[model samples]
Target: MSDQLDIDYTRRNKKPRSLGDSERAKLEEFIEAIHYSARYSDNDFEYRHVQLPKQMLKVIPKEYFDGARGTLKLLWEEEWRALGITQSLGWEHYEVHEPEPHILLFKRPINYQPPTH
Candidate 1:
């Protein structure tokens, strides 16, 4: 879908808005894209890493990306947890002298699973 979410980032009272139908569908589409890439790997021993650029990052609600740490996790934890995926923002170097650019890392089978303790 090529629709933009009508999110008001400058609101008061700090009320959180659930993603619109199109937005949620887009999120699931992105997940499916990542899932398909990880589909053939061994579930127990292998993980897939998908690097998304700023363009693709638009799929996510801006609040999550712009908020404090743990905010993003809190927003999408359910879906991501079910898919064994975890995300973080980091830099990637593309050239010897070029400045590194911020990127999102989506990794499968999260590095550390839930601790039984």
Candidate 2:
């Protein structure tokens, strides 16, 4: 029989699919998208890289074209700091841009900074 989500077998890991509980208690945040933009207007904007987990690179789909992009995931501060990626901006919230795909961007939360241990 299907689960509450329906047409499913067993749920792997956990529920909600946002951020799991143990992952939450351990303080982890991740976001993934095929496209992104900061605003509704303007043709384009600039962004700096906030690299994702190393495992993410493993699933890159085969390129059909020279510039074919793979998955773009946002690995927030807590997620990558222990792995020694210090440049994380720890951003959140994403919105799709029209006539665009294969990009990711976000609004840097006010005074956003990872906690120092």
Candidate 3:
């Protein structure tokens, strides 16, 4: 794994001058979760969703989500399997780190199929 997290700042616009304290905290939480799941799961496990705390949402703008989504996906896929579990079970297993702040968990529908046209 690379020492730096891969965030797509160009997708939206110019790069963020810097991350705010709240944004940084949210990012850290996200990174840790990915690392933990990856460390514990096997190659069969797939990333089904991402749970973001509500409080973190308030602090992070939509741009952050757009920019981070791709990077997060890559991290989850690359690291989560090396650990041991068969599959990412999905958002149903997600739990908020804090109760006061509700987080948005990104879950990919199991039935999702690509368009063949």
Candidate 4:
């Protein structure tokens, strides 16, 4: 007989973490809300084939364009506040008459410093 032994391998990094039932239910509720919003919009929004920052993309879900747009708006507001910038702007939606859809956020720069005599 050979001296080799068979070893069973398990994934070390894939362990499942348990969440409380209430927490799980809340998560499911949020997901369902997002899904419903994604499916029932009359705006006929389409997905745009544009590359966005990975960190920015993580705030919203990939399935719905509105989610991404909303997330971007919130992020931009937060950044502006943190950077002491003051200006109000809106997002623009456009289609290239090709494939996919995209939303662009435009902001006007403002001077936050006080006027001096």
Residues 4-111, model 2: lDDT tens digits: 112111212122124345543332333342212233322232233333444433333222112323333232334333323343444431321222333323444344
* Model 1 RMSD, rounded to 1 decimal: 12.8
TM-score of each: 0.33, 0.27, 0.25, 0.19
Residue-wise lDDT of candidate 1 within 18-108, one digit each (tens)?
5666777666545544422242234422333334333445666666443433223322334333332344321111111112112322223
lDDT of 4 at 100: 18
Residue 8 CA error for candidate 1 (Å)?
A: 26
Off by over 4 Å in 3: 1-45, 65-117
2 or 3, greater by lDDT: 3
RMSD to native, candidate 2: 13.0
User: Which candidate leads in TM-score?
Assistant: 1
* CA RMSD of all predictions: 12.8, 13.0, 12.6, 23.8
Which lDDT values do the candidates have, in the order given?
Answer: 0.35, 0.32, 0.33, 0.26
Whole-model alpha-carbon lDDT for candidate 1: 0.35
Q: Is candidate 1 or candidate 4 better by lDDT?
A: 1
Worst 10 residues of 4 by lDDT: 1-10
* Tens digit per residue, CA lDDT, model 3, 1-117: 111223322433342334556645544544434322322332432233334433445444454333434222222322223212134433222322333223322233343344467
In model 2, what are the clashing residue pairs, if there are any?
A: none
